[model samples]
Structure formats: C-alpha cells, structure tokens
Target: MTALGLVHPGHGAEDDYPRIEQLLGSDIRVDLVHTDLGEEPRRAEALRAAGLAERLTAGVEELRLAGAEAVVWASAGGSFSHGWEGAQQQVRDLARAAGMPASSTSFGFVHAVREVGARRVAVGTAYPPRVAELFADFLRAGGVEVVAVRDGGDPPADGVAGWGEERVLALARDADRPEAEAVLLPDTALHTVSCLPELEKELGKPVLTAAQVTVWEALRLVDRRVHAPRLGTLFTREPVVQV
Candidate 1:
C-alpha cells in the first residue's frame, strides 16, 4: 500500500482525504492529522501560525507510525500566506521532522499545473480578494502565470465545507478565461473531490482543486501515481518521475 500523510490546519474538509483514498482504490492510504488553529481568523497571522514548523511537526510521528511514505502540509491558505520562500522552508522543516519527502498545497497547485502542461492558470478561491491574491503571487513565484484570480466571495452561510456542487462550479466559471490553460481552486477547506468531473466538464478545461492536488502532491513526493479517472485530468495522466 502507498500511504500518504497530510498535515491539515484546524477543521473543515479533512474528510476529502478518505473519499480520495477510496477513489484511488485499495492500495492507497491517506492518513490525515490536524493541527490546532485556535481562535485565529483565516487571515495572514493566523495562517502563518497554521503552517508553523512546530505545529505541522506535532503530527509527524503519528503519521509516520501509520506507514506514511510522504507528508504534505495540506492547507493552501496557510502555506501561501507564508509566501513562496517561507512555504518552501516550512516544507523543508516538515520533511526533516517527518523524516520523509514533504510538500504543501501551495506547491501542490504549482506542480500540478506543470504536470498538466499548463503555464497559465486562473484561480478560483473561497478566500476574499486579499487572500486570493496571495495564492496568485504564490503561483507566480513557481513560474506559473496567473491569467486571472476570482474570489468566491464570503463563505456560505454554512461555511466553505458546506459549499455544494453548484457553488463550486460557479467559482470555476467566474474564474476561467479563454487565455487560461487551466483553472485552479486552491482552498483545501472547500470540499471538491466529488465535483471534479463536473468542474472540468463545465470549464471544458483542466480544473485543479485544492483537495485533489494536495493528495496528488503528496503522492508525487514519493513518485507515486494512481489512476482515478473520476478525479479529473491530473489523475488520468501518467506519472512524471521526479529527478
């Protein structure tokens, strides 16, 4: 079995891992461990805290014991809020702590974009304008062009975890453009595993969602790939062996 560990921030949408593990078939195991977010709002200071090396490492031993071959910091908001270089250091610290290959959702989006052969992408995020821009800048630092960035507005009355298919599709539609080679949805807090097929169909292009890319990124760290056609284009492609 290929076990991938995810260090998530606080609560919301962690269940996407199990759903993806099932979709990836019987051989893949997704072990998730959440770090405390305390009373912090979903802004820069709080997000920076969320990706702190110490907080992320607290769950490393648990995941390592669970047979995790690789670990990923699974919160895009937290990682991107650290900026590109800081996020890189965060994962470096995590790798040392977990004693394995490590990455995060911010790098997941960047690497997933390249895996799909897309150089230009449009971002569709549940974060407000400011937070969404951080993601765009993060993408830029990875050499991917941000053709556009669309905010999904305030969280729903029930929050991002409660965002259904229609709301998710709308965000993709609002963000997609003719110039974009792919559309990126970068909030792991939003549940997107179920609607990946629909999002790609509606956009008629590749759609990379946070939950999906987080798993893909973790697997990529260990040079693993699973055939999950229902998950969308990233999964359907052959694995790119890392050098």
Candidate 2:
C-alpha cells in the first residue's frame, strides 16, 4: 500500500482523508496527523503561524510510524496565507523535516489545475475576501490565471466545516466565469468530498476542492496515481510528469 501522510491544522474536515482513502481503494492509505492552529482567528497572520515548519515537524514521527511515503500540508488557508515564496519554503522545510517529498494544498491546487490542462481558474472559497485574494495571488505566482475570486462571505453557525452540499455548490457558482477552465475551493475546513461529482456537474467544469487536491498532491509527491473518477476531473486524469 502507498501511504500518504497529511499534516492537518486543528479540527475540521480532516475526516476527508479517510473518506478519500476509501474511495482510492485498499491499495492506498491516508494517514492524518493533526496539528495545532494556534490561538488566533482564521486570518492570514494566524494561518501563517499555524503553518510554521515546527508545527508540521511535530507531526512527522507519527506519519513516519504510519509508513507514510509522502506528506502534504493539508490546509489551503494555512499555506496560501504565506504567499507564494513563503509557501514554497514552508513545504521545503516540511520535506526536510519529514525526510520525504512534501507539498501543501496551495501547491496542490496549482499542480492539479495544470495536470488537468487548465490555465485560467476561479477561486470559490469560504475564506474572508482578504484570504481569498491571497489564494488568487498564489495561483498567479504559480503561472495560473485567476479569472475571478468569489468569497462565500461568512461561514455557517457551525463554521465552514459544517457547510453542506448546497453551500459548496453556491460558492463554486459564485466564483465561476465563462472563461474560467476550472473552479477552486480553497478552504480545507469545508467538507467537499461527498459533493465533488455534484460540484463538477453543476459548474459544468472542473471543481478542485481542498481535500481532493491535498490527497492528489500527496500522491503526486510519491509519483503514484490512482483511478478514482468520482473524485472529479483531477482524479480522472493521470499525474503530469515534470520532464
């Protein structure tokens, strides 16, 4: 089995890992190691702190013991809030600490977009407008055009993690544009695994979610790909090899 480790921030949609593992079949394993988000509101600075190399390093041994072949920093907000250069360094530090290939949801989205042959994309996120812009900027740095950025305004009473299918679909539609080749949902806290097919169908385009890309990114670091069409266009396509 190819085990992929995920360093998740706080408590939210971390459960998506197991759900995705089940979908990818018994040949793959997803091991989740939760880290602290620190005692700050979900803002750029706060997310930056939550994604510090130390926080990620704290979870390395657990994943190593779980036989993880690769690791991903599973929070989009946590990584994107650091901007492009900083997020790149963040993953580099993580890879050094884990002694394996490492990536983050921010890079995952960027790679997944290219892997699916998409250039222009839109951002559909539950993050505040400020945080959403960071994600757009990060994408731009990765050479993907950000056609639009639509914030989902505020989270539900139970927070983003409690968001259901209807909210997720609305967020995608709000960010989608006629020229955009895909829609990116960047909040890891939002639950999206169960509605990936519905999302792509509703948008009539590729819908890349945090949980989905995180898993795909982890798999990519290890140079492995699995057949899981129900996950969305990203999964339906083979991993793009960097020549």
Candidate 3:
C-alpha cells in the first residue's frame, strides 16, 4: 500500500491521520508525526521566529523513518504565516529533508481552490484575524480572488480542534457569498470530512476544507488523481469552474 506522511505542524490534532484515511479509503495508508507546537501563543511565536520550517523538516524525517512516501504539513497557517513565497519555500524544505514530494495545508488550500475552478472565494478561518488575512493573501498569490473573509478570532490552543461539526458547518455557511464560487474553511484542526456532503449540499457549491484538501494535494503529489465523488468537486477531474 502507498503510504502518505502527515506532519502535525504543532496544533495537537493527533486524530488527523485517521480522518484523512477515512476520506482516502483503505487503498492509501497514512503515517503521522506530530511536532507538538504547544498552545496558540507558542505556535504564533514559532511563526514569528520562523521556527515552523525547522519543525516541519524535523517531522518529515520522522515520517520518512516511518516509510511515508510523501508528506503534508497539516496546518494551513503554519506555512501561510510566512506569506506566499515563504509558503512555497517551506514545502521545498520539507521535500528536501524527506527526499519525497511535500506540501502544506496552506498550499493545499490554494491548489484545492484552483481545482474547484474558483476564481473568487469566501474564506472562514479560526486563526486570529491577522493570520486569516495572510491565508487569504496566499490564495491571491496563487492567482485566485478572495471575495469575502470571516476571521474567527484566535482562540486558546485546540480551540479549532474542539469545534463540533455544527460549528464548522456554520462557519462555512457564514463564509459563503453570492459572488463567491466556493467557500473555504482553512483549519485542519477542525473535524470536516464527516459533514462534507451536508455542507456542499447546503451551499449548492464547492466547500473545500483543510483536511479534505490536504489529502487531495497529497494524492496529486503521488500522481493518484482518482476522482473521489464522495469527497467533493475538488477531488474529481471535472472542470473547476469557468471564470
């Protein structure tokens, strides 16, 4: 079985691998290494000190040791905090260390948005407003337009992880706009896969979530572009949308 390495960029969501596995089905196995990023304060400080790159690199080698064929930094803000180019270099560094393809949830969001053919999108994030703004900027750099954004205001550590499905659904609903082609929820810490059908059904458009798209990005890196109709529009090879 092909193995996918998942690196928790320190938000303490250990259950991420199982969640990805569930969405990915039994064909692909996931090996995870969590780098223990501590509370939001410590996580933010690491971003400020530019410590996340080092941490992600460290975890990549760990996943390599576990025989993971590729790696994904599951936290979007971890890479996006460094801005667009910073996010690009972050994955490059990870791939260099792991000696395999690499990506971050941040980059995953960008690719996922493009996969859905969304030129304009609405973003809802659980990070502080500033961090949310950076993610939106990362998308713009990827050549997508962000029509609306909702910042959930930074909460304590595990704040996003603690959110129920209803909360995540609400955020997606709130982030949607008539002009937006898609709704983006950019936190891997949140549990999103179970309710993807309901979320998309309600919005009547694509709803891209972090964990879901991170898996999608991993598949792309490994050249496994199987369309997951159950996952959502992004996983399918269908045209994203016409500009």
In order, the Cα lDDT scores of the candidates are: 0.88, 0.88, 0.77
Task: State TM-scores per candidate.
Answer: 0.95, 0.95, 0.90
Could you give candidate 2's per-residue lDDT for residues 1-243 as a string of tens digits?
899999989898888878898899999989888898886446778888998888889989999988999999998888988989999899999999998899999999999999988889988877777777888888999999998998755534567888788988888888899999999998888889999999999989999999999999998899887889889999987655654
After superposition on all CA atoms, what RMSD does each candidate show versus the true structure? 1.9, 1.7, 2.4
Worst 10 residues of 3 by lDDT: 42-51
Q: List the residue pairs that clash in candidate 1.
A: none
For model 1, the run of ten residues with the poorest summed lDDT: 37-46
Model 1 reaches what TM-score against the true structure?
0.95
Q: Over the stretch 16-131, how does candidate 1's per-residue lDDT look in tens digits?
A: 88999889999889988989875544566777787777889999999999999999998898899999889989989999999999999999999999888888899988787778
Model 2 residue 63 distance off true place after TM-score fit, in angstroms: 0.7
State the weakest 10-residue window (summed lDDT) of model 2.
151-160
User: Which of the two candidates, 1 or 3, achieves a greater lDDT against the reference?
Assistant: 1
Give the clashing residue pairs of candidate 2, or none. none
